[model samples]
Each structure stands twice: as C-alpha cells, then as structure tokens.
Target: MVQSALWDFLRGQFTRLPYPETTFTDQVVIVTGSNVGLGFEAAKHCTRLNAAKVILAVRNLDKGNAAKRAIEEATGRRGGVVEVWPLDLSSYESVKAFAQRAMRLPRLDVLLENAGIAGPPYRLAEDNESTITVNVVSTFLLGLLLLPKLRETGQRYNNTPRLPHLVIVSSGVHYFTKLPEQSAPEGKILATLNDKATANMGDRYNVSKLLEVLFTRELAARSPLPSQAGNARGKGGVIINYLNPGLCHSELARNAGLGLKFMKFLLARSTEVGSRTLVHAASAGEETHGQYLSDCKVSRVSPLVSNDTEKHGGKLHTRIWDEIVRKLEAIQPGIMQNL
Candidate 1:
C-alpha cells in the first residue's frame, strides 16, 4: 500500500491531469466552496463549458460574487447565469437552508461538493469537531437533503443526454487512514471522533475522507440507481461519486507542517489541474456511480473498502453509514426518507 501510493503520488506530481472537454451546454450546476481554490477553478470550468446556470454556494456572499465576476471575465461567458448563495457546512441549519433553497431551483443538473477543510486544529462546530462536522456530517446531510432534487432533475430531463451529478471532492489521502474509529462502538464513531481527548488531529482529514468514501458506497447501494457498473449515463438515476484531486497547490493544507509543505512543493499538482478532475467526474458516465475518481478516470479505492468478503461492500462501510444516518436524522428528522 505504501509503495503504490508513493508511486502514484510521485507520478502525479509531474502528470498534468486532463482538462475537461465535456461541455455543459444548458445544464444548471451548483458548486460549493466556489470562492477559492479547487472549487473556484471547477466553477470556472463549468461556466466556461456553458452551463446555463452556475450557482456558487459559498459562506461569504462577497467573495462568491467576486469569484463570479472573475469566472465571467475569464470565460467571457455570453448568456449563462452565475449567481452566489450562502452555504456554511459547519452548521446543519446552514446546510439545511442551502438545500432548501436548492430544491427550489428550476432544475439542478450538477451538485459539485468541492468544499472541505484539512489540517485545522480541533474545534467544535455543532457539537462535533469542525472537520467531522463540515467534511462528513454536513456534507452527506446536504447531499441527502438534495437527493430528491437530483432525482427530480434526472426524470425532468429524461430526454436530455445528461444525468444529474452529485460529485463529492474526496481525497486519495484516505488510502493512509484505516479509520481507526471503526473500533468504536457501532453507533458511536462520530461521537468518539468528537471527543477531542481521543482524537488524533493529524489524521482527522484523512479519516474524514475515508468516511466520505464509505458513505458514498452505502448511498449508492441504497439509491434507486442501478448498482451494476454498466448503467448508461442518461438511463437510470442520479450519478453519485467521490473524487481525489491529488496533492494540490490549494488551501486544503494551510495548517500543515514544514515536512508536508516541502512535499507539496515537489509533489502538488496545480489547483487548475486538480479541479479539472472534479469537472471530469461531474460529466462522467453512470459507471462512476458509487465509485472513486482520480486524474479524470475511475480509479481504485483503498483495499479496506474493496477487499471486503461480505456483501454490499463491508461491515465498516455500513456501520459508518448507519452512524452518519442516525446523526443526520437527529439533525433533521426524516432526512433519509428523501432517498
């Protein structure tokens, strides 16, 4: 595992990820965390590709508007709309409000969940550590809340040659973390993570990414979409997948140490390069459903997920999903029913 991940990382440093060639012609897309970094570049690409409506779901309206102008000027987008809406993933109320507003949109064709934090010191938001709350809990909650809209858009645009996309920007860093919290009692994984005394801050981001991969796997198994890999793009249901943008020159590692800083200097891909992977996954075929993407293609997930002997992935995936579902249900009654 170590040798292979090292090889991929070393190769990825010099490898230029393919920029997206797929156009969004008349699609309506929402990109979270679009105010900067990978989200900013991904949103720009969507606008450049001619998405009919590109909403920058951000925490700060001013920065989002600024990014909107930057994208408009950069792309010279003629008639497509680019607007900003507030979304702070730290709070369930904020995510719920954002999802509520999204459901009212004329049609949601793509939901690019590109916002996440890494390497921050432990802190509580909504009674959990900030990273777990924002990265795993609120992230999935927002996706779950908006599932109906994505399904609705899929049916509404049945004749169109596109499927509604739910793209979560996960990380290959998940390969290094085996989710030690899996040892926690089945229903208490998040709760255990929230207890700072037992938390390992250095591994928080990686563990959160692992949770994202697990939950996406669980969601795909339970969604109305075909679980088989060969379902065509516009044939079945919403396309949900997680992505790894590689080590990138982005804001994700703002709090890392000097060793990582030096590694990033030699190994990080440009955010522009990394963001294209997000755009590529957004336009990908239905085969990507419940899959992990890297460098613009379907890639292997960590063996902890894939080497399961049990049906429906493994026990860890379902255990984490159940804990997350319970948490989400506590936050908002009946969120899982949206499926």
Candidate 2:
C-alpha cells in the first residue's frame, strides 16, 4: 500500500493529468455507447487529451453524431477525426461487424467496453440470456472479437510502443453479489440495512460485473500460451482488465425513471468526474496493466471475487474460468469455439 501522504501526492498529480503534456494525442480510442452519459464524458476527455481519433461506438448513430459535434464544439477543436459507428451489443452480428470495422483502423489504442444496460424488469437479450446479457455476455463477445486488433496496435507501433488496452467498465456493486452460474430469480430478492427492498436491477448489474472481473483475469492468463514460439510474440495477446467507475449520474440511468434518475443525480458525481478512473485505467503507465481500479485509484477488491477462504488464502484465480469459457462458447459458438 502506498503511504497516505504519498497517495495524496499522487492524486494531486492526477488532477493535472489532462493538461497539454501527456494526453492521448495521435491515438485511436474506441468508446462503446459514447453518445451520452459516462461514455460521452470519456470521449470528451479523450479529445481534451488530444486523442488522434475518438470513435463514438454507439448503438444509435444519430445520437452519436450529435454527441460528436457537441464534444467538438465544447473542446473548441475540430477535424480530429471524432466520429460514430453503430454497435448493438445484444446481437453477435453487431459485435462482429464492429470488430471487423475496427480491424481496418491502422491502430487501435484503447477499447473502452463501456456500453451497458441496467435490467429494469426481467428481460432477455437476443441470445435469450437475462438482461445481465448486455453487461456480461455481450460485452465479453465484443472484447473477444476485438482482442486480436487490440493486440495488433502494440506491434503496429512497436518502435514507439503505444500499446493497446481494453477497459471493462464494471461497478461497485460487483462486491455485493455472486456471479450467477445459473440464472437467479429476477427482482428484489435482498434488502438493504434501511429496510428498503433491493431491486432486481442491482442483482443483475452486480452479478454481471462479477463475471466481468473473473473473465478479465482468465482471459489474460490464457491468451498468451497459444503464440508460436518464434513468431512476433504477444502480437495478438492483450492486457485485459476491469474498472469500476463508481456511481455517476449519466444518461444510462435515466431510463430507470425520473425518480431514480433524480436520486442518482443528487448522489452521483459528474460524468467528467466519473470518467477519471476509466481514463486512468485506459492510459496510465505500464505499471497499471491488469489492475482493478476504483474511484480514482487502484484498490483492493472484495473477498468473494479475489480471495478464496478455504484454500489457505490462495487466490480463486481459476474458480470461474472454465465456466465462463463454456458459457461463451454456447453464447457465440463460432466466434469462441477455437479458443
């Protein structure tokens, strides 16, 4: 652990991180669902950081284009190649199509898998999985499809070493729930200390995040072994990691209804504030690779996800690896079959 004084000093330095000296200029960053909310804030920051091209990978092109214009106007800069591409995570074809398009880019610097939906009532994705479907399975599929390109960025810029990063935007709720190996009943199964009924939305969101955390650890562990001994090693192997942006009042939560949105608006931080953790995770120096960060700093995770009590404290590293792999194969048979 960093000493308290040193930690404070580091944080102070981070506040100035967005200045002219070390932004992501000349880099291509693809942020999913970047039309609004936290995604929009992230894209905005990328431009401020001088990212060469920030693609707003949104589900709706119209809204995304508007956001691109708004970001450009706000930043007082134009012609930086900020644009939008359609992406619907619930569909495998959409993810694959997006991946194929991304492959055409000369370099893919940061892939922010930030698009997600909070399951309001019980719902199923096009794949017939629960609403956690978008948060977990769909995002997983997108990342899997884009993994090769993400890794290629590292090699494409090997001389300067502008490595690629995949940031899985998770949530603080991940610590509150277990990953559902089998689907659980939807809606309000638990209660908070105040006697308020916990909504099923919380359950679905939290469980999905847990699965994401496990998947990141597993993907990083397994991807490197398949490279041929003599070929340019690590060419298609990426540093996959998870990030919890904490609670933020973004457009994603407005669909929960005005009351819910209002409550979040009162308690949640600004989108730029929320975007800080993700930006750090996406572009911090080499030491932060594969690190799980919360707030604006990397911190310890919950015991259920990172710790195993019965095995003399060895990490539960492989506890959910096989299960997720099995599910991924079933979800996207052709895309994941070989892996």
Best by TM-score: 1
List residue ranges in candidate 2 displaced over 4 A.
1-21, 179-202, 223-237, 255-266, 309-319, 330-339
lDDT of 2 by residue, 152-243 (tens): 77766654444578889987666766544333233211111112243345566666677677677667555542142245544544556677
Query: For candidate 2, what is the total of clashing residue pairs?
Result: 1
Deviation from truth (RMSD, Å), model 2:
6.3
Clashing pairs in 1: none
Model 1: per-residue Cα lDDT over 192-255, one tens digit each: 9999898999999999998999899889777746435456544438889989888889877888
lDDT of each: 0.86, 0.68
lDDT at 137 for candidate 2? 69
Q: Each candidate: RMSD to true structure?
A: 2.1, 6.3
